[model samples]
Target: MASVPSLSASIQQRVADALGADPLLRRSDRADFQANGVLGLAKRNKANPREVAAQVVEALPTGDDDGLIAAIEVSGPGFLNITVSDAAITRTLAARAADDRLGVPLKADPGTTVVDYAQPNVAKEMHVGHLRSSVIGDAITKILEFEGEKVIRRHHIGDWGTQFGMLVQYLIEHPHELDHEAGETAAGEESMSRLDRVYKASRKLFDADEDFKTRSRKRVVDLQAGDPETLALWQRFVDESKIYFYSVYDKLDIAIRDEDIVGESGYNDMLIETCTLLEESGVAVRSNGALCVFFDDIKGKDGEPVPLIVQKADGGFGYAATDLSAIRNRTADLHADTLLYVVDARQALHFKMVFEAARRIGWLTDEVTVKHLPFGTVLGKDGKPLKTREGVSTKLEDLLDEAVQRAAVVIRAKNEELSEEVVAARAAEVGIGAIKYADLSTSLGRDYVFDLDRMVSLTGDTSVYLQYAYARIRSILRKAGDAKPAAHPELPLAPAERALGLLLDEFGNTLAGVAETYEPHKLASYLYSVASALATFYEQCPVLKADTPETVENRLFLADLTGRTLRQGMTLLGIRTPEQL
Candidate 1:
């Protein structure tokens, strides 16, 4: 289906035609929309602002049944306060409601985007620090894909490092430590438990036993040198860690394909070539026997230029080399036009240097768009990073489980007659939805408190509130047994009805803004506005109990469209909207 023109766009075009220029129009409390473009248009043409406004209004068609503008008046400073006809709102939304995408248009020119996110180290438990990247990246991916852009997900996991040497060597000596039947995939928790035990035991041995430490260092060389036995042991660690990673992602309600799990190890083969190219191109210089790329703009606290180390003096690769290699693969091999790194705010400098280095080496060209979507920390109520009482990072799985538990309590209190099975099922959706919404609703660079109470509250700006709004609309429709939603263009609308209808028409525009800016919070705010509008509509205009049959149907049409808009918006944010909550 073709994209439906929003009421705002239709009105803007009409006003622009009259003024012969772009109308700087915006939603206003004075009217349905207020045009401020006349002030600028008049100043440029050396005409009285009010006269220009009157001329524009005189040229606009009004008072006709088929006309878009119901009324147009000159307000303060020549502002044109325009009220669109109720029929226009109804007709536009009816068109939107008929389409699956809610009339959102696909991009005319789309390109492939490689999003690098949800990075977790191997054989380690994911913590709250990993939440934003996964949730934000997942939402951005969904939104981009919805916009008809080819999105490629990359989970640049931390599966390669010196620590892996200790892990592999320990596994070699204690082959039975990670004992499971061949081809058996370890459960998430069980895998973490086994890996944690081995890590701790090996650490103790490596720290106290000098010979063990030396042998562990040798194991790293073997692993890097393509020794089959060493590589096999290393693969075990990667495989076991993947099992754990998938389990956690499953609990979070995020899908991560095995093929997308490209970690540091994936770019190992390209590291040497990456460093060689940089060195040969003079983009990197040998500083202190290490191949480094220095940027004059990037300086340390001492005012010395900070250099990005690509390779150490001992010929060992640093993170810069691996990252540069990943850029080369993503651009040269995968042919991506855009690259997004959903990482922590602290890593901003690291990525800045890496990106500049790639550009210097000609791996990242002018045609490619590279962005580091940095996110703030998740904080406690005391304005500090969230941590367990023991001062350890809070585990991701434990936090999600607790959220589900809290959701169950809220769900049971609201609907006590629901079966335990139903409660459990709804609890997962509600709990996970709450976490995701809370993260996405906040600005990317701002920290948010991890409070489940506020998150699950039904009266506030939370997922539960939006979910209940949807469920309430569904309940109303169910009560209308034989009265299906039908658009009545002739029926006059109440203030609340017009408000809801107009907001529903903006759904497509809202999505376009999100896709352009890579910000999910805008979509979240828009959905909240929609839910708020629906709440007012319920208080002012009864859906199933209106005065006339046409009124009831028209109101039902508005409610149904609002429900669909909320559902579609929430889905784009990677959230769920249950029929009952």
Candidate 2:
């Protein structure tokens, strides 16, 4: 199916052709759209603004039956306030409603993007600090794929380093520490519990026993040297950590494939080569026995240049080496044209240096687009990073559980007759949806309070509001039996109807903006606007009851399209729209 041209786009083109310049058209309260480009066009050509506006308006067609512009007037400073015909709004939306994609067009030139996110360390539990990266990355991935871009997901778990050596040595000595019974697979919680136990016990022994500490240090050398026994034990830790990671992702309603779980160890083989390349190319110089890449703009508090250390003075590689290696693999081997990192805001400097280093080494070039999408912290009510009462980081699983519980209360209070099973199912959708919406609706690099009360509220800008809007439309359509939704181009539209119709036509344009900027909040705001418009439409115009049969059908048609638009938009943001809430 062909994509539908929005009324705004059509008007902009017409006005641009008449003025012979780009019409800076934008939605306005004075009219359906207002063109401000005439002011600039007139100034450049040394003509009166009002005269240019009049000439453009005179060239445009206007009529009640045939013209797209129903009326046009000159506002202050030569602004052209244009009102599009009701038929144009209804006609454009009808085309969108007939298509499965809602007339959203695919990108003409899409490229492969490797998105690195959802990083969790092995032998450590996930906390609220890990929430933004996972949620934001998941939403971006879905949005890009919807735009026909080839997206490659990477979950860079921390499964390597000297810490693993201690874990492997402990398991070797105990021999049964990480072992599970026959025919028994360790669940996510159990896996974490077992790994935690081993970690704590080994740490206590390593700190108190000098001999054990010496042995642990030696084991690191063996592990790095690829000793089979040591490597086998290390694999157990990685496997166990994955079990825990998957469990949390499942609860959050995010899907993560096993193959995409590439951690630091995945690039171990390339670390030495990556460092050698940088040193040979003069991109990195040895400073005090450490291979480093320094930038002029990045300086420490003492005004000394801060150099990104690729390899430590002890001949061990650091994160910079692994990251550069990952860049090489993604661009050269995977043929990716774009690289995205959804990480903490604090890591901005680190990535800045890493990207510059890659550019200097010729791994990242002009042909590749690399971006580091930094996000802010999740604060508590006290304007501090969220933590438990014991001052420990709040666990991700526990936070989700609490959200679901709160959602169940809200769902039950709304409808006492709903079965427990139904309530449970809907609560999961609403609760998780609320968390995701709250995170996604806020602009990036801004901290948000983790308040379940405000999140599950029925009145405000939350997922609950949008979910109810969708459910209400579905109810109207169900009662709309024997009366099918049909577009009536000849029927006059009410103010509310015209408003919704115009907003529905902007769905494709909204998505295009999101894909270009990699922002999910824009899509969230669009859905909220649609819901608000639908609310007004319901209040002003009756769907099942109207003066004429065609009026009722026309309103129903608008309602159906609104519901579909809300569903599609929510889905693109990795949110669910339950039919009944």
Candidate 3:
């Protein structure tokens, strides 16, 4: 409704009609566009593929309506090599610019999607794994929301569980352990970070003393049984952990509302009924005193069956049980039409079994789609999982702090006149954007190296590069003050303008593709293309110093439109574009 059908779609429709219902067109690499259905059609009707291709091409209109088709040629094996027209490219861009949503239409049938991500265990340090999950999930949520889907974010923080027992016991002994607020510069310097001190002291006592371990285990039982004293102590641990989590999320520039922090314990009530239903439906069985589901196809390296244990032998519910319960609540209570779990790829098998079990129990049905957007681990330069120099898990706060510092250097170098406060703020956005963009710019299923140098680099597929492109356009538009952007259909477009126009027109289609496939990398790649095209256009066409006033105004309009498109596209990827950087 916003613009005419894309050139690819229009051409496909023409070919489909020519082929009729007998044999349809197919994609071929031999041509820009190909129809391989001729081979199958020939086999069925005793016709040659080349002859069928020729007939289909002839049937395709060679008029103004088919303006996108500069030429339609038949290649070997009956492939249609169609070349699109420059005018068609310019027209689509102009039309897209005229619309409010930039030619991207909302889905007529949108569904409610509940995404569960950013799940960090309480009393434990937030690691790079949690950072990756939060960043990727944020981008996915943005893209889905842009597509008009009702997205409910679930930041399943590990605020509940038995680990709280050890933390609470330790906190009670060291009453002032969890005390802290924002630190001052030179006036206040602490020997240890608040979270570090608490975690270390708790871990030390838990490991060294047998009596402490016994008390911790007992504390867990008490906490589970709703013992008031133990529960109150547990709340302190959860609260302290939240302070640490919020500081990290704040640095990351991600919005994680407190109400969405549904920990595993939130599903405790439903876990019992979930297991009961699973056992009754034969989806799970008691094997070796533990409730589990074994698959014939999934096996260990020793050829033994790999069972998904829903409940431990100690009669305690595990992650599988918690997840199953969450699924039921999401579908029945939350009324979510879709459930998305953006967890690590290492848990793919676990999710696979859980989904199967849920399906068997009728919690997840055809009407409700469930997807596990499992992502790969982030590896260091050594090609192994990222870790600290001492081989410990890298703390997310430390990683983010380093990224922000590095970004400050880049911002200062580019904009020397900026105030310290502005530099810090812009640096945070650029730094966080770089980190997130590094993870999102690649296929989520593949492992990528966490290289700060490459991530914040000024050139090549980085967030800073895109930000610079957007800012540069803004600068040009600002210089051309009072010169409004207006499309001139009668005027012929330059090569750079045509190229930029073609890419801009495909924004809506690209968004739809990214949403349908649950692939943010596609959207990232598309934004990169847009920035690249705009750069080429800027280099070739002068916006503020064109030959004539009208020409300059039209070119400025083009630049303004490009800037808007870039800003919108980058925002969908959860990246911010600084006005001057």
The lDDT leader among the candidates is 2
Candidate 1 Cα outliers beyond 4 Å, as residue runs? 181-185
TM-score of 3: 0.90
> lDDT tens digits, residues 1-581, model 1?
99889999999999999999888999999999999999888899999999999999889889684468899999988999999997788788888888988898999899999999999999888999999999999999999999999999999999888888899989989999988768875689889999999999999999999999999999999989989999888999888888999999999999999999999999999898888899999999999999999998999899999999999999899999999999999999899999999999999999999999888878888999999999999998888999999999999999999999999999999999999999999999999999999999999999999999999989889999999999999999999988889998887888988888888888888888998889999999999999999999999887788888888888888889899999988998989999987
lDDT of 3 by residue, 1-581 (tens): 54446655666776678877333433334433555566777678888878988887788776365666656787778656765565566566667777767778787689999999899877677889887789889988998998899999998877767777787777677787766546743111131256567778777888999999888888888888888988787776666667667767778888878798889878878888988888888989999999998888999999999998998899998889999999989999999999999999998888999898888778989999999998888889999999999998898878888988999999899879999999999889889899999999989899999999889888999999999999998887777767777776445678788667767767888889999988899888988999999889988998777887767866776777788888998898888998988
For residues 246-274, write the lDDT of model 2, one tens digit per residue. Answer: 99998899999999999999999999999
Which residue pairs collide in model 1, if any?
none
Q: Distance (Å) between predicted and true CA of 226, model 2? A: 1.5
Worst 10 residues of 1 by lDDT: 60-69
After superposition, candidate 3 runs with Cα above 4 Å error: 1-4, 14-78, 83-85, 174-176, 179-192, 548-550
**Each model's C-alpha lDDT?**
0.92, 0.93, 0.81
Question: By lDDT, highest first, what's the ranking?
Answer: 2, 1, 3
The predicted structure with the larger TM-score, 2 or 3, is 2
